[model samples]
Target chain A: MEALLEFLSFQDPSVRMVTLGAVILTASSALVGSFTFLKKKALIGDAVAHAVLPGVCLAFLLSGEKNPLLLIIGAFITGWLSLNIIDFVTNESKIKEDTAIALVLSVFFGFGILLLTFIQHGDYAEQSGLDHFLFGQAASLVGEDLIIFLSVGLLLIALILLFFKELTLISFDRQFAQTSGLPVKWLELLLTSMTVLAVVIGIQAVGVVLMAAMLITPPAAARYWTDYLPRMVLLAAIFGAFSGFSGALISYVSPAMPTGPWIVMVATTIALLSILFAPARGIIFKMKRQQENQLKILTENILKSFYHLGQKHQDMKHRYSFDEIHSIRPSIPKPRLKKGLRVLEKEGFLRKKENSYRLSAEGTEKGKRVVKLHRLWEVYLTEYLYLDPDHVHDSAETMEHVITPELEKKLEEMLNYPDRDPHDEEIPYT
Target chain B: MKKKILQADNPVTEVHDLTVTYDRKPVLWDIDLTLPKGSVIGVMGPNGAGKSTLIKAMMGLLPLASGYVKMFDEKLDDVREQVSYVPQRGTVDWDFPALVKDVVLMGRYSKIGLFKRPRQSDKEIAMDCLRKVNMEAFAERQISQLSGGQQQRVFLARALAQHADLYFMDEPFVGVDMATEKAIVDLLQEMSAKGKTVVVVHHDLQTARQYFDWIVLLNTRLVASGPTKEVLTDELLAETYGGKLTLLNEVSQEIKNKEFPNREE
Candidate 1:
């Protein structure tokens, strides 16, 4: 708690620098990743992240120093190389893109590990925290690192703001953008460079292995909230910055916990929560809709069964017992049937008297619509589509509960207001 | 106020000996076409007849293996601003994070130029185009909320906002409802009346006759290109669609199967 308070207070310059570095790096990555996610090129971020390690190691070896700028250039070069190789392999050969991505990612990451181990045992003096690039060491961030992040992050945000329309056009429809006189190739190159820059800036704070998560997760979470690009991008930056800040503090407060994985865990938790709870596209909303549909179908089926019984007895007031209803639909379990009955009664659709149930006035009108829709659909299918009458009843059974009043009117008009179904059964009217 | 229609000396679009290939397999072969001004022309062909490919190649979206495209009697690069192309309905991600107004405003991006935001007049023009397509009600709605027909209308409104002399549309009517289809046909006629050349890659043979006054029937090659009344003959249609082109079918099949034997080496 003390560590977290100190980190948030900015009293400790080192903790302040780490938090600020993480915020900018993750914000930039999340902004860029929104486009990458929409383009369906998310795995490319992974490949580029892994491909930058060897460049960082080689940059250290050649420069004989721990200069952040030199290492960033190295990371960008190798990251760009990996992207070009993937493009070349996909364009020139028969190998599919997923396979090519896998090959490149494993090879580059494996090579990076080789160089990393060699450097660890060598006679280099300042190579103590170099291996932290694998996971990340947010504690190692200092004044110089935050400066690099601030400039590069601000530059990327500016470029995205300048070319927002062009980037969006290309990502959504490259051919349309090209025909609209946008220089699609240059736009693509610009976007690739930005993505590479994001990955490079992010690798130091989140490390190569987990940087891809920083790039993709926040935007994915934000997508559930809104469908406007600017809002989505803004929300993604906020989500990423929040996770980055919290992850840094949590790691700082807890010993032996790394910041990169913690950041990823926090980001993933946000994504999961968004997926489960967000309106319009979330799982909970979908499940509730499904449940409502199931209830509607059940209510209609019970009403339809009652309508048949009433007609058979030549009486609209005919009351049916539990055994009689059970005999009509044996497929419905007893508990479910009882529940349906109770719900129907509660909704004023069914009335029970002395263990016998009959449709109320409102329920009778509803039953007529359901039955009319079924017959109308069956007739339209047989007459319009030339389907066998036998084949259409099953389909009509399902459509009866689903067809809206507008569709029912259209079906009746298309069938010329038919008075009878294909079976020559009289169609009821409301 | 009527818009000034440019009376350029060159035809709207002209292609000479155009050939396009994907992975060394020819998709379009030796196509020659000259489209004049103020007409709704339909490029008609079967499933693999390279109808969409012709527009893509002509618009310079895809690199041509041979031949060149002239737009408004000038080179494509020089006259790009004067042309608009609407790709197939399935080509774009409708779920992209944008409102209907934002997408329609994209049509004005060329005029807005790089680094400059759209003006209020541009926004009004975009809204005007949306009203033309009966989509003004959806202007502020996110694009993903639109139905398939509404989405097609949005794309048409975007093209209309371009105010281009030449337009290319690839199967705009494929999935839309009847109301949208009628609206598109009316829009095409209106554009034609305004002296703009509109080229559509179409599939329905019945509607092609009713919708266009000129037609280009293709089957990997130009089987016929002329007025609809003269070119849509039984013999030309047979040549364009008949199974007699077995060799072309075989080649297209090979390419579809992706058999690149030499690529392994």
Candidate 2:
């Protein structure tokens, strides 16, 4: 805890720079990644990240120094080239986009590794610790390294603010954007450059190998939280910045922990948690909705069965024992049937006295609607769709719980307010 | 407004020698046509016959092999604001993070231009368009929660918000319900009455006579193009359908099922 406080409190000047650098790089990348993820071009971000390596090494080889500005320029060149190459290859041949991305990513990254190795072996001065770019040495960042992030982050945020609507429209509906005369080709170039810029600066903290996760994972988590793009971008930036902060702090506490891989790990955990526990779109929420729907169907089925028994005995207020209800609905097991009976009773749909249950007034009306919808569907199907009455009963049985009041009315009007269904059975009415 | 007849000058859109291909397979071939002003035109064709490609080509979406499209007898770049496009609903990822109003607000972005925020007046216009489509109640609702019919209506609202003189709709009626289809048809007729030329890529021959003032028939080639009453004869339809009545029947059945394939590709 002391180490964490010390790391977060920025007692060490280097710790402050690393944390700030990591946060800015990641947050900007997350903003750009939201658009890429939405465009379903997520893997393109991965390719661009890997493609930046040769540029960084070539920048060092040409300049003979590790100038952050020069390295960024070099990285931008090769990164921009990589995106164009992918586009050219996909357009010129039958090679699919995924295939082209994989091809370009491997070749560019392979060339970068070769260049990096050459730089390490060359007689260049001040080349110590250059291999840190491979896995990201966030702990090694100083005031100069922070410049790469600050400049790029400002440019990214500024462009995102200025071109948010154009960027969004083109990403969501390119054909419409083109027809609307938004200078679509120029917008695509702008977006591609932004993607390249985001990847170039982000690689310093997240590293080449794990930089793609820095771009994609945060947005994936943010999507589960909201259906608004601006809010999603904000959430993704927070998630990305948090991962970056945690990764930098962990390495600050324990020097052996590599910050890049750790950042990827933390981001992946957030995405998994968001997938499982977030509200509305999350897995747990969807499962809960499914369970609620099943319970509704079960309770409605029990009420419908009770209503049928009342009709058979010519008494609406008759009380029935569990065995009698069970006898009518032999499909339901005893425990489940009893549980449903209690649930209906608790819902004020049934009156319970010594385990014998009778339908309440509201429950009677609810039960009648279900039965009415079923019979109304039956009459419509046989009368309109010409389905056999026997076959129609099974369909109407399912549609009973699904139909709304409006649909029930439409069915009645379409069937001409029929009292008797095709089966010659009395269609129950309220 | 009276029904429109195509003339040589002052056409809403004129395509000459336009061809499009995918994987070297020709989707459209030598398609030369002129659409009239203030008319509801229906482009009818079979699957893979480039009904969508035709509109896309005119909108400058597809790279034409050897042709040009003139809007209002002028270059497309000059008259872009006067034109609007509604792509097939299925072409979009409906799960996009946006509300109904946000999507409609995009219609005004062309006018608002680059690097500027939409004003309150723009919001009012978007809301008015939403109300026209009977979707004002859903302005705040996220788009993913809507049904296919509602989504189609939302797309219509977005197009209407553009306030363009020429509109191109790619299969707008495909997945919509009967009532929604009627509403859209009414909206199109109203637009035509107000002197907007609308082109729709349609598949239902049953409603072709009732819905359109002009028809452009195709089967990978220009089979016919003229007024609906003159061009929708059994012979021209047979030629456009190319003796594949069985498949046409199956496709028409699919339309009735509200599940037609919106695009050839």
Candidate 3:
């Protein structure tokens, strides 16, 4: 952690420039990625990331050197062609979309690997740095490379902001977008081109193998944190920028670590965290809510049990023993008895009269509501769900605590205000 | 029913011998229909009958194999401002992370032109349309959280925000609840009463007679089209539904054969 702070405040001009460039590129990639993720084309980013490898290698082979302009052109051509081919194959042929993506990804990547091997054994000695494209080396981004990255990154951001509405429409509903006379086809083409441009631009920094992760993970993580598009985009960009900067810093501090893998690892870690810790949708939060609900149900059931015992004893001064209450509800454990009784008494639903419990006036009313809801649900289950008379009791036994009062009334009305459940037990009135 | 063109002084949309094909196979063959200036027209057809293709062809969304589409005596492109379209519910990804307001604001994009941000006026128009659809409360809500009926309303509100003189809706009632269906029909009726042309691609045969003032029955070709009372006879119903199962089987077989040319013994 201290090392990270030192790197951030480092006086080195070269480190500052690299950090700035990484931040810009990462923000640009995540902005584009949000739309692509929303469009349900997350896998398309993976395909394009791998598909640009051959173009990069071919440009390197033909030019016999690493020229940024030629490489970007070649990468764009290949990426665009791969997208078009995927479209054609899916439309004209019976192959599914995943298969089409897999086909193109493998074919392009295979050819790229072949070219890379040939280059490794060929006469060009300056091609040693070219291996960085396979997996990124953020430490090597210099003045010229940084300029190209920043310019493309800025162009991408500008296009996204300018065509924000059009892209949103197309991503959400292409058919509607087209019918609204919004040029759906051109917008789709533009979006795909922008994604390709982002992938190609980040190849030297994030690398081909992990470029797809940068495009998808940030948006996926952002989705857990936000429901709105603009916010999602902004959050995704922040996550991406953080990942890029940390990855670059890690590589800068270390002697021989690559940037792409560390960046992906960090981004993926953030995504996993969001999936578990997000306020509404996270698994941990959902479990917590369920546990609380179960606790409420248990407490309510205990109160209902005390009310029933009080009515059975038929003495205003009656004090039922704990073992007797437990006998009525055998499933409840001994540990919960004290807690349930204390909660019932605190809520004015029960009274402790010398080591025994009796239902207060409020307790009787509350118990009646629960019993009414349970019996109504049983009737509903028997009538609406077509469950056998005998099969309804167990399920309604569990649902009694959760059904709202409004639903209980509707169920009563629907069942013609039944006075008794399927078990021939009298349903207490509210 | 014999074809008879309306003698209105100014019709909102007129399609003359409109033919559409996919890869040289005819999907919609020679359809001649004219929608009057102020009416709610329902286009009904069996599955795969090119009902949606007809709307797309008219909107210039799909290429016309052979024919012309005129809006208010002008070509479709010339009168694009006067037209709006709503596609089927399933044609888009609902999980798209756009707010209800943002989706509706897209209706003003063509009017706003390229490279300009939607201004305050555009947002106000969108909000008004949302109010009309009873979805004003959902303006800031993400579209994924909405029910099928609410999604349809939002789409309708988007089209309404366009304020186009003519609206083409494809399967607008698909997946919509009965209440939403009633609300949308009522809205369309109000639009027609106000001298707007609303063309909808509908599927429910039961509601066809009651909801629409005009009907166009299609089965890869125009089977019958006219006022609902006159054209939707028992004979036309037979023509639309009769032999449908056999036809579907044949089409499926043909597709299989085309996909696998060497499958035969």
- Per-residue CA lDDT of model 3 for B1-265, tens digit only, reads 4343333346677888887767545677788887777889888888898999999899888877678999989987677888999888787777776789988998898889877889999999999999999999999998889999999999999899898999999889988898999999999999999999899999889988888988888887787777888778888877876646466445646754565331123
**Model 2 C-alpha lDDT per residue in residues A47-83, reported as the tens digit of each score:** 9999999999999998999898998999999999999
Residue B264 lDDT in candidate 1 = 30
Model 3 Cα lDDT, one tens digit per residue, A1-430: 7667778886788888888777777778899998898888999998999999889889988998788888899999888889999999998887999999999999998988898889989999678878788888887777887888789999999999988877877777776666666777788888999999999988777898899998999999999987787788889999999998887797788737878998899999999999999998898999999988877887789877766666677653367878887888888887787778878888888888777888788877887787778888887888788899988878887889777867777777778888888778888775
**How much of the true contact map at the interface does candidate 3 reproduce, as a fraction?**
0.70
What's the TM-score of every candidate structure? Answer: 0.88, 0.91, 0.88
Q: Score each candidate by Cα lDDT.
A: 0.86, 0.87, 0.84
The number of clashing residue pairs in model 2 is 0
RMSD of each: 5.2, 6.0, 4.2
Q: Quick one: ranking by DockQ, best first?
A: 2, 1, 3
Which structure is stronger by DockQ: 1 or 2? 2
Question: Candidate 1's C-alpha lDDT?
Answer: 0.86
Residues B1-265 of candidate 1: C-alpha lDDT, one tens digit per residue: 1111122243578898898887767789888888768999999989989999999999888888788888777898898888998878788888888899999999988888888889999999999999999999999999888988999899989998998989999898988999999999999999999999899999999898899978888888888877788777887788789745678758766865775431234
Q: How well does chain B match by TM-score in each candidate?
A: 0.90, 0.88, 0.89
